[model samples]
Target: MTLIGENGHAADTLTGSGFDFGEEPNPYGAAGFPLDRRYSHSLYHDADAEPHTGTGSMENLGFGAQFPGHPPFRASESFGIAHPEPFIPEIPQAVPDSQARLSVGSVYRPSLGARGLPDLVPDPNYVQASTYVQRAHLYSLRCAAEEKCLASTAYAAETTDYDVRVLLRFPQRVKNQGTADFLPSQPRHSWQWHSCHQRYHSMAEFSHYDLLDVTSGRRVAEGHKASFCLEDTTCDFGHLKRYACTAHTQGLSPGCYDTYNADIDCQWIDITDVPPGNYILKVQVNPKYLVLESDFTNNVVRCHIHYTGRFVSASNCRISQS
Candidate 1:
C-alpha cells in the first residue's frame, strides 16, 4: 500500500520516532533539577550500534545494588548509560515494575498498511540495519526508484516467503507506575550503542508484533521491534514529560511515551506468503511478561486488516488482552 502524506511524501517514512522535544516541566521532579533522579549510573556501555547484553549477577554487592537502595545514574553522549553500583536489580525485583503500567499504543506511521515494501530486509542483513533517521536521503531515493522492484525481484505474487514490509510507530506508553514509571536500573540492565542510530538502545526486546488469521486465529507473520531507547517522548495523564531516557536516568514516567517508529529497519512482518484476505493484526508490549506490570490485560492491541492481492488496509483497531 502506498501512503502519501499531505505533502505527497510517505508519512514520516524516513524518521525514527525519537525524543528531542526538550524537557516538559516536571512538577514531581527534584527542585533544582527536573529530570527525576532515583537510580545511579549504568554500568555497561554500548558501542557502534551494539550494547552489552550482560546481565551481571546482583547477588553480592552494596545495599545500593539491592532493592530500596538507589545509586548515581548518568547518560553518556558517546557511550550510553553509566551507573555507579556494581550490581543491578532484576526485572521482577524492580520497584517500578510493581506499579508501572505498560500500554501499547495503536499503530502509528503510514506503515499501518503495506507501505513498507522498501523497508524489507533479508535475514542476517537485518542485524546491521539502521533506522531510516540515521540513513541518507539516497536510501529513500533508492526505495522510490525501486518502487517496482517488488514486481521484478523476489516479491512476485508467486513468492510466498517475501516480507510484507510496513513502517510502524509502535508507541510504548507508561500509563501508571508504583511511585514512578517503568524505570529499570541501567546497571543490572545494559545499553547498546547503534552507531547508525547514533544513540542508546535498551538491550532488551521491548515489543513484538504478529499478524493472525481472523477466521482460524493462526499466526501468519510476526516481527520484533526492539524496545528502543527509554524516553518520555510524549505525555498524557500528568501532561508533564518526565523521563527523557537521558543521563543519570532511563524510563517512561506515567503519561509519558517511548516511540519505536517505522523508520527503524526491518519493522515489518513477512506477509508475502499471507493469503489475501481479512486478518487480525496483533501487537503486544512486554510479551514475555518479563517486566512485572500492574495490569497485564491492557498490554495487547489488535486491529482488523483487509489484504487484497497487492494492497492492505487496517481498521477496527482496539486495545485488548493478548
Candidate 2:
C-alpha cells in the first residue's frame, strides 16, 4: 500500500519486506514483532533499518499484542504519550551580599535658601501678599556596603554624549515578596552620578521627590534633581565630593547618608501661593525600577508636615510601604 503526500511525494509505503501483517509471529518475535537480537542489530548496526520505515519492526510504532487476562493495551498509556511530566520552571538564584542597595534615610524641610549662598527673596511679581515662600525639601539616604558595588565605566560609543553613566557591575537576581523575579539582566546605561553634589541621578521618573498636600492628596510641588552625596555621614548641608562612584571603592561609601544640598534649584518646590494647611511630604528613592535593590518597599519616606504662613515644620517622617 502506498500513500502520497500533498507535495506529490511518497509519504509512506508498505512492502512485503517491511512487515508481515500476518496474525502469526515471524522468526524474530510473536505477532510480527522483532526479537531483542534482531531489534538491537537493526537499531545499532543497520543504518537502513529506520524506525519510520517499519524495517525496525511494527512494535517500535507502538503496536503490540495484549496478554490473555490483562486489559486491552493502549499505545498512549504504555508509551506516556497522553501523560507527560509536569513543567517546572528554573528557579532564579539570589543576589550576592556585595551589591548596591539604596534606601531613603530621612525626610526634612529646610529653610528656603541655597547652602553656602544667600537666600533668594521671593520676587514681588511672583509672590502675592497672602502667599508664603517654601524652600527645598531634603531626603537623606544611604547606599550600604552590601549594596554599594557600583563602578564607573565608559558607556558605549553610541552613548558618548551622556556626560554621566555608571555600571552596576555585580547586581543580584532578587525575587520580590510575591515570588516574582525582578532583576533579569544588567542594564546598559544604568545610573548617572552628578559630581557637583555627590549624588546619583537618573532620567527615570521614580528618581524625583514629590510634595503632596496631605489633606487633599494632591501633589503641590515636585523636585527632579534628586542628588545625594555618598560621603556625608549626616544630613548636614556641607560641601562634599560631587560624583563618588568612580571606581568600586570611591562609590557611595557604605553606612553613610548622602543628603541633598540646598544649593541645587530642583531640590525644592515653590509653595508660596499654596494655602497654609497640614501636608504630607513623600520622598521616594529610585522612583523607577531601573536599578535592582534588595528591598524596594523601603525606598519611600512619608512625613507629616505642618505648614503655617510663617513657619514650615516636618514631623513623624518614616519609611512607608512601597
Candidate 3:
C-alpha cells in the first residue's frame, strides 16, 4: 500500500500485512519537537490494510512525518538533517554605586609651639618656619551595593628584582589624593613638587590639602600628608572632639568617614612666610581620580580665611560647589 504525507508527497510504499500503527512507539516524538508535543500520524497505515511493493522502509517514512516541511527521506542514504541552534537569552549584570565624598571640616592656625607639629629642620635651599595653618579633613564614602570596598598592598621579590604595589582584589579602589584645581594652567611637572610627600612613605592611600590665595588663585602652601583615621565625631557633626589613627590596614567602611585630626603631621601648610591676606583653603579627596566614584563634584571644600601679620583666623568654611 502506498502512503502519502500531509504535504502531498509520496512518503513510503509498505509491503506487509497487519501493521499496527497504534502499537508502534513514536521515535520522532520520544524527546519531543520544537514545533509541537504530539507526533504526526498522517503517513501511518491502517492495521487491516493489505501490503504492497515498497522501495523505502518505515524509518525513512518517519522523518517526513516528524517534520512536515522537511525534504523527502530515502532508505539507502544516511540522514543528517540540520537543526536551528537553541535559543539562549542573555542576562545583564548590575553595576555598583561607589561614592567618595571629601570635605574640609575646620581651618585654623595652631600655636607656634604645638606638640604634635613636625619640627622644621632649616635647609639652606628652603626657608623654614614654625607657624602653619591646619585643616581638619573628612572622607565620607559608601558602597550602595552588596559588595564591600576592599584593597591591599603586596610585595613581590624575584631572584633579581623586587616590587611593591596596591592590589584591588575586592571592590575597594583607593589612591593618593592631590590638589585637583591648584594650578589649572600650569603643567603637572611644574606643580609636582607641591604634591604631598608623606603619602609616598605609607603603603596606604591618603588625601591632600592646599592653601590657595582666593585673589591670586595660586597655591601658597599645601599639606604633604592627610591621614585616614577615626574621628571622635561623626561626619555629620553630631559630636565634636578629635580624630586619631585607628584602622591602618583596612579601607573605610561604607557609610563611614575616615577623619584625620588637624594636629597630625603634614596636616598644616606653613604660612610663616605667607603675607597676611585673605585666602581660600581647599581640601580634595581622591584627587588623582585613581579610584571610581559615583560623584566627583562633592569631593572639595573651601574655607575663607582672614590673616594678619601677627595672627591668622578662618571663617565661612563650608563645602563648595566647585
- lDDT (CA) for every model shown? 0.43, 0.33, 0.31
**For every model in order, what is the number of clashing pairs?**
23, 9, 2
> Candidate 3: which stretches are off by over 4 Å?
1-205, 226-248
Highest lDDT: give the candidate number.
1
TM-score for each of the candidates: 0.46, 0.35, 0.35
In model 2, where do residues sit more than 4 Å from their true spots?
1-206, 228-253
Instruction: Pull out the clashing pairs in model 2.
Output: 99-147, 100-147, 101-147, 195-242, 195-243, 198-242, 199-228, 206-287, 206-288
For model 1, the stretches where C-alpha displacement exceeds 4 angstroms are 1-179, 185-189, 237-239
Clashes of 2: 9
Regarding lDDT, does 1 or 2 come out ahead? 1
lDDT for model 2: 0.33
Tens-place lDDT per residue, model 3, 180-289, is 11111122233222123222122122444567888888987654332233222232234222333332322332223444444344344545346778878665554553
**Tens digits of lDDT, candidate 1, 199-257:** 55563556667779898999877766554466666666646776665434666665455
lDDT of 1 at 87: 36
Give the worst 10-residue stretch by lDDT in candidate 3: 117-126
